[model samples]
Target: MGTRWTISTPEPLPADAVDAVDAEIDRIDRAWSRFRDDSMVADMARQAGRYPIADTDQPLVDWYRRLYDLTGGAVSPLVGQTLADAGYDAIYTLRASARVPVAPAWDAVIGEHAGALELREPALLDVGAAGKGFAVDRVAEIVGDSFDDFVVDAGGDMVISPRSRGLRVALEHPSDATKAIGVVSVAGGAICASASNRRVWADWHHIVDPRTASPAREVLATWVIAPSAMEADGLATALFFTPAAFLRGDFDHHREGFHHVTIRRNGSVEHTAIPGLELFL
Candidate 1:
């Protein structure tokens, strides 16, 4: 949601076409924003411990639950508590700080759902990954009926249709914003790049690993391709919490329509089993 929007219509769009797409995007923003007061997700978070039986929120809850399991609790909504402890208590300050915050307990804490989320716990439900990708997916659904080809860039995450020659995306250097570490092509589905540099506040950013309750080390960025924007979204965030040693194993296990390219702190690159993965550059 922090990213901008760029539309490549197969043909020059009528002025109304732009307005319509913008309206649809705005609608998506209202429904899925984590910070917007009117957003459905915000409402659910506000109700947290109050909703025991997941209904509409079930998909997200179920997805988060799985991540909680798969990563041994490396990714979580409960990371809110960790953020507060590290001084990222509010949105305004977090936006201002632009720092990668390490979870105070990452080395020791296990992120398994201790129990159903409880309001009493000093935890926060930060849906940084889920929010934007989900919004992009929703936008695609809304626009699919009208436009056959389009790309939605929600921060660094994206989803595109094969309507274009091929979707060319740039991966920003983790330490340097102006330079692109590399570029990748996405077509027919979704691709996302999650990095430590996108948003930092006081040396702290929103991506938090529930395990050990801190920031993930070693990998600077992970570029992933998946069947859905949502999957790519979660996987990219998951990469932040995972170790490079485990990269191959994870790819082999879940590798399907997915491909990945990762940049290390030293500026070297490693890729998953994605075919012609180097073609994008």
Candidate 2:
């Protein structure tokens, strides 16, 4: 939510198209942004209570629940407290605490009841793993309603409308932003990527493993393509801790129609054999 975004269409859109998209993004930020004190998520951190869940936010909550189970709890929205303790707080404090708090299991701390979200205890919630992608999908929907074809790019997590030509997306090297390891032609749907090198401070990155309450170091980068940006974004983070085979086989990612590539710490690459993706390494 802190990054830039771009919307591209074949021709000039209506004058209010940008305004509509901007309004939707602002609404999403107000509802879920952990960096803002006035956000609904921030209110949850301040106190434990049954907070109303907007109908638009239900998809995000449902996706979080799905990813929580898909990754076996490796990806969680409940990692906000740990992230803040590790120096990624509302004020952008990059200094890690002497003792970072452990993230509680999702079921142990939160529940959904009668259209409301009830937190058993006060805990900061971070939905960065997939929130951006969800926003991208929403934006795409707004744009699609006006134009049949469009491209919505949110800090590189994108949703491209179906086109015969497709869109060529470069997979940036984990260690060097100037270098690219491969390219994929995204014909349609969404493609989301996560890299450890993007954010770093005091031996920590944004991607934290909730199980260990520490930064995930095994995989340097991950890329996923799915029917929706939300799925792709959530799965990209899930790939950091879970293997592709298990994700595809056990979690039925294969049936769901997605492909992924992961760069490990040793400079080795692990990926699925799928069309459209080509790796130089």
**Model 1 C-alpha lDDT per residue in residues 132-206, reported as the tens digit of each score:** 666677666656656787666666677788644566677776777887766666666888778877556555565
Off by over 4 Å in 2: 250-256
> Which lDDT value does model 2 have at 126?
93
- The 10 consecutive residues of candidate 2 with the worst lDDT sum are 247-256
- Give the Å error, residue 100, model 1: 13
lDDT of each candidate versus the true structure: 0.61, 0.89
- Segments in model 1 whose C-alpha atoms lie over 4 Å from true places: 11-49, 52-57, 95-123, 163-165, 243-255, 266-268, 273-276, 279-281
Clashes of 1: 20
